[model samples]
Target chain A: MRTHSAIAEPGAIRWTLTAFAVAFLALFVALPVASVFLQAFEHGPGAYLAALTDPEALSAIRLTLVAAALSVPLNTVFGVTAAWLIAKYDFAGRGVLLTLIDLPFAVSPVIAGLIFVLLFGAHGLLGPLLSRHEVRVIFAVPGIVLATTFVTFPFVVREVLPILESQGSDQEEAAVTLGASGLTVFFRVTLPRIKWGLLYGVILCNARAMGEFGAVSVVSGHIRGETNTMPLHVEILYNEYNFVGAFAVASLLALLALATLLAKRLLGDGSHGGQGQPGASQEAR
Target chain B: MSVTVRNLTKRFTASAGSPRAPAVADASFEAPDGAITTLLGPSGSGKTTVLRAIAGLEQPDSGTILLDGVDCTAIPARRRGVGFVFQGYALFAHMSVRDNIAFGLQVRKMPRKEIAERVDELLSLVQLEGLGARYPKQLSGGQQQRVAFARALATRPRVLLLDEPFGALDAQVRVELRSWLQRLHAQTHVTTLLVTHDQEEALELSQHVVLMRAGRIEQVGTPHDLYDHPSTPFVASFIGGATVLRGRVEGTRAAIGPLSVAAPDGALEGAGLQAFVRPHDVRIARATDQSAVSLGKIEKLVRVGGFVKVELRLPSGEAMTVQMAKTELDALGVAEGDRVLVDLLAAKVFVEDYSI
Candidate 1:
């Protein structure tokens, strides 16, 4: 057998390469954001508080949270059922259906926003039917929700499908043969088996739901205190040259992102413990 | 409680590049009530397929499965009133040991308090009273298997089906569990069908052993019957370790390896016949001073647990194994390259040679 030397790489080469990679990341990914954060905190906590408590910013934050809350639950249900159908059975057109579910991931977010517009906006297909019933989709919170839903639709399914496929159908069959009804087996056995993957998918969905901007921006109409989400509000403040206010709001959203990541870590740790098989448990597999 | 499988057949359609093969072919058998019937076969021999078909997991191509004279061919597994203890135990990993045992009762929508009481009862019955709160993963393999058994027995089904119940255990655990299973069967008196490839397990655990090959039944009989009066060459070779020697038969006698023995008549003179002899029946004899030792060399000596296997090469160069006691090894003076004489006392005779 060939032996490996247990020495570290040459210090100069390793340090140089590490420095180069760090410099690249700092320049490309971290510095611009750090500059914004530094600028935001430079003024004081009072300015940050003012920006957050501003009625328009508050409404925008509330609207974004509401839309995400509404979308995540529905998407979770859809994600789990769709994943179950795809992973368990061999039905005709299954491949086509899987591709269609993943289509949202590949499609441009702008086009996803536009598709809702073309279908629900005035002078578009079904626009007359929508207007006759006074069903306001465009320039509305529901419109923002629909766009965000479309853009983030694939996260849960993508995260969950592979886990379900690897878990095999034996446990479910055993449950059924042991006299569990279909629903009982699904809830009692099947759900527990893939709870971690499902939770992981939901975390991804939540992350995407919070960060989604492009799709929501197009359909939101940006009514200052009404339809504006935090992201749209961030864009509006920056455009109006209120740099300090913009950065403050952006900091709040960044904190929310950080909180989500912490939650992901906490939930991930718990669910990893819940997995069944020793080797295939989440800690390793 | 009896399970009657009639003309049961199942064919799995070929997928992609695989050839279509019948998993089960026109299998039929009756497992009597309160008796343990074992389905014995090697892997992929359709033994598990027969069990699964009986459990309603696989739909047979054309057949009827009746449990206690009730035609259950179209019934679902849940309603068939059959308890299936799967290989690997299949205990719910998330539930505590007590809750796992109580799952069937809960599924039947039993009263919550009664379910709790039954769970406690089963935990004690399985000798796991203190481990009630422990999950399946925390228990040992044997404990997990007992919990699985208790879980199956919770519903009090008419029949019990075990698929290689102890196959996943270590040798010592397997032997201990085998006797435990026999005692459990005696106590419950539920009609049971166990499928296993280990002949020793089948012989020791079941009242009746159904020997299967190529998706068909070769023989079904008690362990003693199958071992002593095997109906075919397959049964003879499979049940007991016996070797066959080819020879020709006359009216009442046959010429075998350096010896002539009386053969059952229906043996055509000058026709070929095969004699079956167990290794233990072959005795080692000392050659007289006047007669040179029948020239057979000791090719190999293998020490098995309590017995030593002495392999001898006949003058005809055919190899045969003779078992000798460790105590008698000194007098026999058997060693590699030593010439020895073997005498066949009584041997089974077959009209034709059938070896697989």
Candidate 2:
């Protein structure tokens, strides 16, 4: 059987448009990312190594890793729970629930940080209670983690929702009929079916959690050794006229983004891996 | 185990202040032990819903599901000990045939050795012995269906439920799988209930047939009983390809478009009725024959495999279909636009005043 091409054969205008897109990506995205590594290594490998292992840089790396480690898994759990509730069952306010899950995506990250500050700041709502309890949330590691979680909240849920919705409830129903408990059905049947999409979501969530800048900056007090995350550390270094040091840390974030892209390619947009076809997996169920 | 359901009813509320008709309204039937009983109907006839309820996949608003004389209506699906095969096979695409078959046993935490042995046994039983290493996508449609059956049978539940198991396959594979299912049922003797909309499939594979219409059990009997002695006009027309003709009954006879046929027993006299006659029961002959009951013109002749379906229009403009052997049709030399006489060999008449 013959299939239609997704786009018609390239005319002069189409070729011109394609060339313009390629040039735009190269100039805006590729060059800037390339310059991060290029400028970081301009002082040679020794300086680059020194800048990476610098005390402040190391602490920022540790703080960023710690924040990502705390936030990604928490958001992943939330994402799966939210997706399961939204996709597997229907109830009143289902549409409203979906829109709420997507609220993080629509809200600006800086605004997300501001909202948290309003709740946890020294004089904001609940601030007095928190202060009375002698526990600090704003301008601390906890605040950084919370802000990062807020910014990356929608990644896993969005990725897993469509896959779960397409999968239907047949496999889970079959598992129940076959005498598998609810947990067993989820771990054995439901998890395996959505593993690729879930992984894709987690990868994106991890990327956002690691690279988050604006939100972490607002909540993180930028106390060098205590609460400075990688993005905040990069700002500190750049403002201190340590250009190579700043680019070196930025290089790591760029590498993380590259790794995420590589993982997405390997997973094939969550559609090609695993069963490769929605109907095929449905048939198996 | 013998499975019986009483007064199974399920209703879906479409939205606030608007309730849709029940999917299965007061459906009750008994599937005998160690026999294949088929719930047969068109889509939305509640056949699949009844099967799902028996499997405990769908909770009934009010019903008692008795399995081997035990009340299991409130039991959850996982504890009901019933194996359900979905219409689309529902195989785990990520698992090989062996692992797929072993899933149920593994879930029950059966010993590894025992799980392997049982998987192998099922693989051989389904005639998919060597293909156990292949993924579901690597196999053909028929192979995947067999794997699904094997997986469902792995746990050896008291009852096996199949919901249009062959509904996804093509014609040739559907026929092959139907016979395969029959053989499997015979060997297992596991008291199976199958749901299908195909009349021929239900007739060919089932020992007992439950005919359903609009969420109600229309009739329940053996395939032969349902086919030969349908209790309702729906059953009579649904079980076989029957042409329903509108007419008025006079005593024991029904007059339809210049022809008269014996009315079904208990049909009211002097009342408008619908006569249900199988296509093959409508005999056709040359119009010149004096023994002919009614005269009509052959509108079209459709050859379907070994038999030809003849479309005829009566003088009163009522359309009727007659099935005849190809050789018999050839011998009669009938063609489109030719006038012919049709004889109603057998018919079942019911009062047409009532709505289904």
The candidate that wins on lDDT is 2
The TM-scores of all predictions, comma-separated, are 0.86, 0.93
Q: Give me the displacement of residue A93 in model 2, in angstroms.
A: 3.4
lDDT of 2 by residue, A79-165 (tens): 899899988777788889888888888988889899989999998998999999988999988899999988999998888888888
Candidate 2 clashes between residue pairs 3 or more apart in a chain or in different chains:
A284-B90, A284-B91, A285-B90, A285-B91
Residue ranges of candidate 1 with Cα displaced over 4 Å: A1-36, A53-59, A114-143, A217-228, A271-285, B17-19, B244-277, B288-295, B345-356
- Candidate 2 residues lying further than 4 Å off, grouped into runs, are A1-21, A266-285, B15-17, B264-269, B289-293, B354-356
Give DockQ for candidates 1 onward, in order: 0.39, 0.55
Candidate 1 lDDT for residue B350 = 75
TM-score of chain A of each: 0.90, 0.90
Model 1 Cα lDDT, one tens digit per residue, A1-285: 555467767668789999999999999878877887887877788887888899999999999898899889889989888899999877778889899898888988888888988999998898999999999998998998998888877878887788778767766776777789999998998787777677777877877887788889888888989999988899999999888789888988887877887977776665555544332254222
For B1-356, candidate 2 gives per-residue lDDT tens digits of 99998999998778573779999899889999999999999999998888988998888889889999899998899888898899988887777789888888988899999998999899899999898878787889889888888998999989999999999899999998889888898899999999999999999998899999999999999988888888888899888878888899887789887788887667767779888888988888887875465789999999999999999998888899999899999999879999998788888777776534
Residue A191, candidate 1: how far off, in angstroms? 1.7
